[model samples]
Target: MIPQIRSRVLWIVMSGLVLLLASVHLMIGGLDQHEEKSQRLRFLPDGHFLRTASLGYRELTADVLWLQAIQVMGERKVSPEAGRWIYRLLDVVTTIDPKFTWAYEAGGIALCTLVVLPEESNRLLEKGMLHNPEEWKFPFLLSINYAFELGEDAKAAEAMALAAQLPGAPSNLGRLAANFFVSAKAPQQAIDLLSDLYEKTSDPGTKSLLGERLKRVAVERDLQLIEGSIARYRQSHGGLPSRLEDLTTSGILEKLPIEPYGGRYEYDPHSGTVRSSEISERMTLSMKRRRDSL
Candidate 1:
């Protein structure tokens, strides 16, 4: 009986010890997993910190070192290389605080000025859009790039249209699009687009500018059509018209389209010239003044 009781006690103690050891092992495994996830979330994916460490500065934290590196790169103006550095820094900063608006703005501007390649700048803007697609400025930057730098009016128009669809985009963007279309030489389309914008907007400055642009586009379109008609008439009749009336009489034009800025089109019979009403004598005076100053 005494031997059986001792054996039972020993069995119970050993079982308790085995259960405690198993619990401790599971707890250690869980802690290790949590530590790994925390480490992964703390750093950016690009190995910038790893590179920094490889460069032999072990004392500073990764975030501070990254900021210092970005500032140095910015001061040097090395362009695309600087752009790459800034992008890496921004990635870390954004990962730290996804809602940081200023970081996005600064990152976008840095990408714009330093990248030197429109496609890369565009990719940066797209990344910003992923964070804040409803913001007006990202798409606006894309539109400006397409319109002014790339001279891709169709792409510019598409970007501007997307910007306009956003909640807070400036109303003037519509007028800008119309002007871009006109500058791209699609005047009728420009006229149609601006006419709609003019009706929608009531701001005095915007209205006046759109109205003027619309009139100018219409006049230029008419001038081109008339010029073509005049050329065809000359080909058929072997000479140019002596006056605006001659064109109407010969069925080359029904009536001369008056110049938009308040004057009749002037025709010089001797030189076969058509003069616009708003000729600036200022150019001659400006030249004289510059000569006098020199």
Candidate 2:
């Protein structure tokens, strides 16, 4: 009886140890397989095939694929084929889960920034709009693509109008939309749009881009004001002034506007034009040549 009891206890302990070892092996195998999958994700089956294979876990499978897509896009260097690869990955993720609005937004913005493909970005955002009619972000992004890349302020205004009408949208979007519709040529309107976009976006890349654009527009606006003041100074004084300071000294301007990039304004008597001192000499010469041509 004692021998039988000891044999039973030993059998139970050995079985538990076997089970623990088996579980550890399974976990290590799963990690290995996951790493392999991530490395070879580009060679995976297409969305249609994966969808069919998801076994009723379409959304879950898509979530995983979307994460992989993000990894692929962020890690990949800029190569000729990188854009195409990113588009394919994003397309697959969207195809599997059409209602994933964040995926669409990220993909659209990535296409624009990474690939410089505004048309493709527009198509992706438009598709997101169709899937998420009640969501305002898609149309807002579409407006950005149109205004910045395509230079279609009218279309941008229309899209912004749609965005403003959507639930949860900001009340001030209407004013920005109206500005875009009223004038395609107004730098102020561009500035307003960019400022709004810069504030609304949390993405560092998009915010940086908007900041640069805003600086350019602000510089342009200051240049216009300086030019007008210069004209007024010449009208009163009977010739171009010796320097930009003369405009302020003669009361044409209260004080010269501060340069957007922290450089003093310079006046060229030979060209009868004012330029920002911060502008590179190359850019100054290019602008002078363009004015001469015009």
Off by over 4 Å in 1: 1-66, 73-76, 185-294
Give the backbone clash total of model 1.
0
lDDT of 1 by residue, 1-294 (tens): 999999998777666545533443343224334654223223334444333432332222334534443453345344454456556655654544444444554455445443434555566576677888887666766665564345577887777778778886667677666666666544465456557756865644335545654565566556566666677778988988766677788887888786777875666666665655653222113234545789
| Ten contiguous residues minimizing lDDT sum, candidate 1 | 279-288
Whole-model Cα lDDT of every candidate shown, in order:
0.55, 0.68
For model 2, residues 172-284, the per-residue Cα lDDT tens digits are: 77887887788643456556756876797786645654565466556666777888898888798889988888888899999988877788777797677877776543211
Q: Which stretches of candidate 2 lie over 4 Å from their true place?
A: 1-45, 75-80, 185-294
Q: What is the model-wide C-alpha lDDT for candidate 2?
A: 0.68
**Angstrom error at residue 119, model 2:** 0.2
> lDDT score, residue 216, model 2?
55
| Model 2 TM-score on a 0 to 1 scale | 0.56
**Highest TM-score against the true fold, candidate:** 2
Local lDDT at 256 for model 2 = 83
